[model samples]
Structure formats: C-alpha cells, structure tokens
Target: MTVIVRDFRPEDADAVSRVRRAALPFEVTTPRSVLFHVESANPAGKYRLLIAEMDGEIVGTAQVGVAYESGTPGQSYANPQVHPGRRGQGAGGLLLRTAEEHLAAEGAVEVYAWVLDEPEFRAFAERRGYRPTRSAHFQRLDLAGGTLPELPARLPPGVELRTAADYTADPRPMFQADAEVTSDEPSDIGAELDDYEDWLAHTWNNPLLDLGLSTVVLVDGEVAAFTAAHTDGERRYWSGMTGTLRAHRGHGLAKLAKTDSLRRARAAGCTDAFTSNDAENGPMLAINKWFGYEVCATEVRHVRTFG
Candidate 1:
C-alpha cells in the first residue's frame, strides 16, 4: 500500500482527532478544537497540519510549526501521531519527514519533538538524529470516583479567587501572568510569550478552554496564581496550565486554584482529569500526587539540529 502525505483539510478533523487520541490518550482533543487550531494559528508561527493517507483513509497526522513566541529564532516543533493499529506502515516516518522538510524550508535550524518514553519510540527518534533532553509525566485522576479535597474555608487575607471569564473587559493581566510563568518553565527549548494578540487568538479564544472552569487567584487585586482548564465537553478534562507568579510562590495559591478548578470540573460531570508535568518540577508534582493523580505515561522531549 502506498502512503501519501498531504495538508489537513477542514473535513479531516475527525481523522486528525482520532489519530491524536490514539497516539496520546492522556490529552483531550475534539474535532472543533482541531479546526479551531488550524483557523486561529498565527502566520508567524508557520503552522501546518499534515495527514498521512493510506488508500484514501487518514491513518496518521502531524502538527509542525515554528515557535513564534520564543525569544530565539530557528526553534521549531513537530509532533507526529500514527494510529495504534496502523503502526509499522511507514506512515509515521513519512509524516515526520514531511513536517521536518516544511520547517526546514521555513528556516528552522533546530527542530524539537515529543516522543513516548518507551524503548521503541525513543529508538525511532534517535535513529533520526533526535536526542532526548528532558522527560515529563502524564498524570490522571479519577474525578468521578475519587474524593477530592474540600475548598479552603477562607483564603489568605488579601487573596481572592476568580475565573478567566471575570476578565471579560481586559485579559492583559492574565496574559502578562502567563508570559511571566511560561518564561520560567523548565523545557528542552526555551520560550518567551512575546505577542499578546497571538496569545488571545490561539489560547484565550480556544474552543476547548473553559474560562468559567478555569480558576485564578488574586492577591491584593493582582493576578497571583491560576489554573487553566480545557475540556472535550464530555467525560475528559485537562489542566492546561497551573502556575504561580513569582511573588506568591509559597502561599499555596496555585494549589488553591487547581483544587477549586478540579472540584468544579468533577461537579460538572467530568470523569477523568489529566495533567502533564516536567519530571523536575518537584513542587507541582508533589501537589498532583496529593490529589491522587498517578503517573500514567511519560514522554521525553527530543531535539535535532540541522547541520
């Protein structure tokens, strides 16, 4: 069977979502979210979604783009996913090659990808000159059956809780908070959130982002901590980001926002909760452990530099 790689079409949302779910079950994805990503991507990102078709059926897909928000140039990312049942058909390799070629044409000097921490997956990446840098764990919680901690009786003085929806008039504060926290995150490639308009178009307006379910903590009327939530509108939910501003590190506001969001998610009938954390983030990892979230899978960030 001949495998062909091509750009994703609007009608390929289902197939693309299916491939991603099969490849990375810990994350929640939907057809609408897939289309929204394609539609809202900034041109500076040079984003491209490609699918691998075998006999007119899409069996694999990849998202390739430059890290437009990064302070450094030539940093790009491409994550390719093949259906579990369709592995070994050369579709994954084709998708990866297509993605890399596209990024290279766009002047990307270094490309990064996430590979499952299994032996085979690591070998696949190593064979293509990608070297593993850091690892992260995908954790899951049984929100429906497990008991969650009760919200604190009273927040610390000068602290209050709110949601992203509360900032309907202006989201610049949230953007600034996100940018500050994101710059300090541990990762293989460094990134800085530089564009407010791009962040709004891609993250703030994402269909899966439940602003009402996302909790933010305010200390003295400043955005001090936040837990961003994303959902598939059914049984699955994800913590997009849980971060604390620099000045509020030890106050447990991050935990407060996360717990409040998780409680709201469970109350809304979300059965499963998922989050990813860098292996080195001890504080966040400990917090997740307290919530009964267990590590289900791991992925290593891998990078390849063009000669």
Candidate 2:
C-alpha cells in the first residue's frame, strides 16, 4: 500500500482529530480545536498540519512548526502520530520525513519531538537520530468516581476563589498571572508571553477553554494562582495549566487552584480529568498526586540537532 503525506485540508479535521485522539488519548482534541489551532497559530510559528493517507484513508498526522515564541532561534518541533491499527504501514515514517523536511527548509537548526516512553517508541526515535532528553507524564483523575478532598472549610484569610468567567469584563489580571507563572515554567524552549493580544486570541478565545471550570485564586483582589481548564463539552476535562505566581509560591495556592477547578469540573458533569507536567516539577507532581491523579502515560522529549 502506498502511503502519502500532504498538507491538512479543511475537510481533514475529523480524520486528523480521530488520529490524534487515538494516538494520544490523554490530550484533549476535537475537530473544532484542530481547525482553531491551525488557523490561530502564531504567524511566526510557521505551523503546518500534515496528514498521511493510505488508499484514500487518513491514518497518520503531524504538526510541524518553528518555535517563534522561544527565545532561541532555529528551534522547531515535529510531532507525528499514526493510528494504532495502521502503524505497520510505514505511514508514520513518511510523515516524520515530510515534517522534518518542511522544518529544515524553514531554517530549523534543531528539532524537538515528544516520543512515548515505551521501548519501541524510543527505539524508533533513536533510529531516526533523535536522543532522549527530559520526560513528562500525562496524569489522569477519575473525577466522577474517585474521591476528592473536601474544600477547605474556609480559604486562608484574605484568599478567594473565582472562575475565569468572573473576568468577562476584563481579563488583564488573568493574563498578567498567566504571563508571570508561564515565564517561570520549565520548558526546553522559553516562551516569551509579552503579547497580550496574542494571549487573548490564542488562549482566552479558544473554543475548548472552559471558562466556568477554570479556577483562579486571588489574594486581597490580586491574582495569585490559576488553573486553566479545557473540556470537550462532555465527560472530559483537562487542566490546560495550573500555576501560582513566584511571589505566591509555597502557600499551596497552586494546589488550591487545581483542587477548586477539578471540583468545579466534576460538578459540571465531567467524568475524567487530565493534566501533564515536566517530570522535574516536584511541587506540581506532588499536588497532582494529592488529588489522586495517577500517571497514565509518559513521554520523553527527544531532540536532533542538524549539522
């Protein structure tokens, strides 16, 4: 069977989403989100969504892009996935080669990809000249059936909990908090969140973002911590981000934000909750563990530098 890789078309949304969800079940993805991601991608990212077809059926997908927001130049990423049932047909390799060619042509000096921590997955990447680097975990919690700690009888004096909806009139505080916390997040490519308009468009306006379920913590009218939430408008909810400002760390505020967000998600009929974090982030990992989140899968970041 001949497998061919090509640019994603508007009609490929459903197929692309299907392949992505089948391959990475822990992440939240839908046809709408797929389209939005492609359309709203920052111009400088040079994002390309590729689809692999075999005998007229899409069996694999890849997202290739320059890390324009990264402080370092020439850093790019290519994440490819093939449907489990279609893995042996050479679609993944073809997609990878196509994505790499596109990235290299776009001036990428190095490419980073996340490969499943499974032996075969690691071997595949290694054979392709990628080397293992840092690792991250996809954690899940049974929001509907599992036990969740009761909310503190009373939040610490001067601390208050609010939803993202509360800032409908003005989201500057939330943006400020996100910028502060995100700047400190552990990432191979540093994210420079200096553009408020970009944040408002790509983040605040995203369709999957569940404003009502996202919890924000405030200390005396100032944003301290927040847990951004995303849902498929059904049983699945995802913690888009959970962080506390540097000045507010160690007060258990991050935990508080996540806990409140998860509870609100459960109340909204979400049956499962998902989140991920860098393996080295002990504080967040411990907080997730406290909420009974178990590691569902692990992905190791792999990098290949072009000579």
Candidate 3:
C-alpha cells in the first residue's frame, strides 16, 4: 500500500488523462493534449508532469511549471489531481510534496494551486500551508437541449461572424485579438502573449481546438470578439476562451460570439459545453448565465510562499 511519485513518461499519457478527467470532470482533455503539454512546453517553463504510482497503478498527477510567460518573477503553479475513487490513499500528498520540491528547485518563490471547495480538499491544502486567495467556477451548458440563445437575427451592421478556420491563411489577427483581450484577463500570475509562433503552434494548431466550432466576431473586418472552442471530437465542448477587445466591450460582442459558438456546437452534435471563469469576472459570468450555463463546481485558488 505504498505510493511513489515519479516523472511522467511518454507511455503514461493515458493514465494521466484518466486521473485528470476523473478528478476534474468539468474540464476537457485528451491523451494528445497531455502529450502536447510536455512536448510543446516552453524551455523556460521548466514544466514537469509528476505522476503518483501505487503498486504499479498510476493514481494521481501534478502539473508543475514556472509561469515563464508572466512578467513577474517567482510565480509558479502545481495542480494535483487524484482519481476520486483513490483519494483516501496517500497519492495526493506525495504528489503535492513532489511537485512543490520540483517547483522550488526551479526557482519558484510562490506556488499557486486550485483546491476544490469541498472541505476535505480545502483542508488538505490548508494543512500544507496554502492559503485561499481567489475562486473560480466551472460552468456547464447543455448544448443539446439547453437554453442556448439563438444568434441575433441581425448581427449589427458592419459586423460579421466567422470561424477560426477562416484565418487559416494567417492567424495573426486572431492572435492580436487574443493577446489584447487576454492581457486584460484576471489572474494572480498574468501572462503576456507576445510571441506569434508560440501562439500558432500551441493554440491554433492544438489538436483539441475546434476551428469550425470556434466563432469569431469581426467588426469592419477587425477581430472584435471571439470564442475559442475545444472539443473531444464527439459530444463534449469546452470554451477555452471568450473575449472581446477593449474597444468593443460595451457592444454585446462577447454574447454574440458565444451565442453563435454555442449554436454551432449544438448543431455539431455536441451534447455538453463546459467553461470556467474567475469568480470576479462578473461580466462573462453574467453572459454565461444568460445562456443558461449553471455553475457545476467551484475551486478556490490557493497559494503558498516559501520563505
């Protein structure tokens, strides 16, 4: 009944995915994405996927990495996910300790992790010297039969809706829009998206990104708003990001992009749609609620500063 923590191997992708899906059912992930996380990691990230194996079975994992994209120094994250059925075992604690050690060695001064709002999970993190900071919610929309509002009959003059695939020739416009909107997103460790090649490789070319289902709003031929979609290629859809450029914020562009994307998803036979946002992001949360998305689960961000 001993649990051991080790580094993720090429062959352990499936096991890692299983643990993640079991622990965080609201998020969408595949083995390919799991492998991509490791292979396409930025050298500066110092990314390490730690796995906890017990008696020859992998039970948990921690995604540990330095927040290299952030302008701030010493920001890092390590999220541990253990299979729900295997939680009583010591897999989670071992994985956390291993992740912290790895992150600390990589020059991390403060490590952030998401702890489930449940008492046991919160207690687990608190006992390890982590303190609650901000919270986030995982919301789900029933793409098949839910109250996804129909696309507006008139999309406001000079505004056009297009799929991300339309930018196949050159995605710099989408990249520009994404960067500006993302720069405004709330986070303890903010990211700066300045590299075009990195965005093309890691985002536009990612296997999970559904180009056809992702809807973008263009106003006067400019990327005004967009919703990036991720799917399991069958029935599950996830809103990886939905954002509106600063200039277009008060114009209902966010809702327009999401409405069009949701209808597209339902038409594509996706049964469920998942999304998440920081608790303080009231505007996006309100739009999601308008689309009938219900908060399925909440997780609080926890951080520990190493002296």
Residue pairs that clash (backbone atoms under 3 angstroms), model 2: none
74: Cα error in model 2, Å: 0.8
> Clashing residue pairs, candidate 1?
none
TM-score, model 2 to reference: 0.98
Please provide the root mean square deviation of candidate 3 (C-alpha atoms, Å): 0.9
The digit string of per-residue lDDT tens for model 2 on 167-202 reads 979988888988888888888878888888899989
For residues 1-307, could you state the per-residue lDDT of candidate 3 as single tens digits?
9999989899999989888999999999999899988989888899999999989999999999999889999999999999998998999999899988888898899999999999999999999999999999999988777777777777788999999999999999999998998899999989999999888878888889999999999999899999999998879999999999998899999898888888988888999999999999999999999899999999999999988
Cα displacement (Å) at residue 10, model 3? 1.7
Shift in Å, residue 30, candidate 1? 0.6
Candidates' TM-scores?
Answer: 0.98, 0.98, 0.98
On lDDT, the leading prediction is 1
- Candidate 3 residue pairs in backbone clash: none
lDDT of each: 0.93, 0.92, 0.92
After superposition, the stretches of candidate 1 with alpha carbons farther than 4 Å from their true spots are none
Off by over 4 Å in 3: none
Give the Cα RMSD of candidate 2: 0.9
